[model samples]
Target: MKSKAAIMKTSGKIELGRRRAVWELPAELANLHHKVSIGSSCFLKLAPRPSKHWDARRAAELAVGAGFTLDKPCFFRSQIAFLSVTKIESLPDSVGPKMQTLMVGLNPSPYSSASRVPYGRPGNRFWPAAHRAGLISKDRDIHHALVHHGIGFTDLVRRTTRRAGEIDPPEFRSGFERVKSLIEWLKPKVVCFVGLSGWRIVSNPKAKAGIQPASIGLTTVYVMPHPSGLNAHASLKDLIGH
Candidate 1:
């Protein structure tokens, strides 16, 4: 008989394969030869295919009209496609328009994608630090707890990549508009970016990385060390400046 570990391994492999398949959708989008743009720095140039349906054209138009242009290759230099049709379950509840603090990260980890939970990564210290920093009351149901505290979590770029280095600066700039919209709606008083790398992506010429006490777009923007295990210096003290 197969061991329990063997069964678990097979399940894990199957799941990984499924996710890998989803990540490949860009290829299909490219096959349509639809010019598309993602964020501000990327573009796709292609002759519209005869077999393409109207909706594909419409999606392409939306892509181009939203600063996604077939006219240039300034953004996403390697590829271009319409935003993925994210499943409804992929998003959290609509955060209210009165947030006190907001936390932003570079992107979601594969574990977060798998669990459909924000900051769900086990290697990410966001939860523990927030809890200990008095951002949350214990670890009980962190999502609900955060909402209760007028706190919310989001990313600089909503797109998920295997690693943070895969992101482009233009994408962060493009996402800034969306971030502003969130802040306007949520009215968060403090906006904390996850790490130095993230701060640099959206930084002005004068601001430095590490802990910062600054403001951007009607919200106070604070720079904190990333909670990823990769950031060895990202202790609770390092982030909170204690």
Candidate 2:
């Protein structure tokens, strides 16, 4: 016996089998057959013919509509559109007491939100610079840094966006309050901001890279150029030096 293929309607809702699990799709993406599965992580598999319409941005929007966040979209060996998703809308702060340094970013991108690792995006130079700077023994391992190196990760804003420019000034101010509270409680020796933009908006509009004069509670603040590949002002060596 063969089970009939599930159908998605223009309303972007579909019920699956007896489990009755529902997924919301965009109108343009409707009528596609999707397979939803859960493992150590959750994945939404969409089987649509290869078309110019399907891209990473559209996939991200679809995932957001369904109350999920996605990593970089990929294709399975079978050429199916594979999207790994997290139910949470934003990346959670990875922090602990007895921290040497706390690294903060402006916000989460879809890449990091899905992987549950800050700066997990491939083109992002954060991990490489961290490794070169002797901050972490292993690359791209947040747990390793937290557990072994006494380094913690967090973000100024909990929102996830494709670009940091998409975040507004109000979010930065509110997020600074949250980060300030966290620092006062944890009292890390140093608080390192991966980008100057967020700190500049919230604390010092004219702030340049390196240690800032103001302290968040008793913690010293250090600002570094964003390690995003798109940020060409700083080179890999410059980031390592920071």
Candidate 3:
């Protein structure tokens, strides 16, 4: 009997025997040639290097954010290891014209990024509250909400973080401008911000929850409490109500 040899290829390279792989990034990716090591356990480990512009840990993030499907990297001891590469870190905007409402979140959490779903973190009350509020026909179904309920989803910032507090005010300001342009173009009936902190910094410092006087073109603006489980300020009931 003869043993079988297996070979696999992805967007990057896998060098046999050498236990090293180099990602052939496109020119638009700033010509990054990130290297990784294939361990005996069949895990891809990022090879550390000193670079002022690029960080090894962020290589996978950048790839996923650029619409590449890749496995997320995890920390193994002191080294960063990837089980596979096939998901995105940044959630894409799911808005379309004639949308009844556009739900804007603060940013993508690491959990949500790995799951490839907006507000997908298990502890996050967004889906549950939206379901209870009759905003979506199916729980955690973004497509169903958009198609059936006219509810769209987007984020103020596409960056993924463990906590929303990590996002800077400048990011919020810039993100708001982008959202404003989107609203102006899509012309959604209502723009609902799922986090008050972002709206407060971008639009009004003392902005309160609910419908605001501000309007992006003809779209109404509404501020809601953050649906994060860590946000004790607003309960699930309060989120549903908002």
Candidate 4:
């Protein structure tokens, strides 16, 4: 990870704590992966009908609960309510005490959740940049990078969100508790926060990008810019440099 600390998937084997699972992506599921991993931020919002339906009044109330403003006439005219925040299945974290570095993100983007892979979103710069930086082979088999290369993955929050901006305060607080416990348990050599905002929220408010005087049990902590394309301050090369 760049910036001293930072943060999918390929088919091979995944190591979670002491357990190892055979990892493979079936070809048939590629369409769904493409939709969520590519379409979430750019377009294709969660629709209301498939999971839950809001009959006018309930939709408005729930929208407000999710922090959406109903004051605008143009807001959320589609059939789907954005309330499907929780994923059917949370992405599995790949972690172990023997790892050289543990990369942590703020949470799952809807795309990442759908694909069951960290930073699986096509819009994210993480995978490509890591390859460019020589952190991974050009083929970028994530399973090899983690199982054989001593890299691991995790998230500050377990929930999925269409946008990081939608995360409520309670979610962050609970997520932080879980993160601390994970760090204490694994004690990876380095714990890198993929986004500075995540570090700021759950960690020292004054901490900036790069190594910090933070530790969980024996693990060192650092912060870096998120590899999202939306973060303009850090480019692909810059991320590699970090």
Best by lDDT: 2
Residue-by-residue lDDT tens digits, candidate 2, 6-44: 544323323222222112233222212122322224555
Q: Report the error of model 2 at residue 13, Å.
A: 28
TM-score, candidate 4, is: 0.62
lDDT of 1: 0.50
lDDT tens digits, residues 1-242, model 3? 01121223444632121122222121122111112211212233343332332244344443433333444554433333343443235555555455999998888777765565788878889889988988887987766787789888777777678878898999888777767766776689999998888889898999999999989999999999988888899999999898
Clashing pairs in 4: 2-242, 3-242, 47-80, 48-79, 48-80, 48-81
Checking candidate 1 for backbone clashes, the offending pairs are 41-74, 41-75, 41-76, 42-75, 42-76, 64-68, 97-186
Give residue 227's lDDT in candidate 2 (0 to 100).
Answer: 90
For model 3, the superposed segments whose C-alpha errors exceed 4 Å read 1-88
RMSD after CA superposition, every candidate: 13.2, 14.1, 12.4, 13.8
The model with the greater TM-score, 1 or 4, is: 4
Residue 210 local lDDT, model 2:
97
Better of 3 and 4 by lDDT: 3
lDDT digits (tens) for residues 1-242 of candidate 4: 11111001213311111111111111111222232332222111322232232233333332222212233322344443222222133454655446778888887776775555678787788888877877667343545677676677777665577887788766776667766765665577888899888888876778888889877788888788899988899988889887
Candidate 2: Cα lDDT at 114: 69
Instruction: Report model 1's TM-score to 2 decimal places.
Output: 0.58
User: Which residue ranges in model 1 land beyond 4 Å of their true spot?
Assistant: 1-94, 138-142, 209-214, 240-242
Task: Rank all candidate structures by their lDDT, best first, as comma-separated numbers.
Answer: 2, 3, 4, 1
Score each candidate by Cα lDDT: 0.50, 0.68, 0.63, 0.56
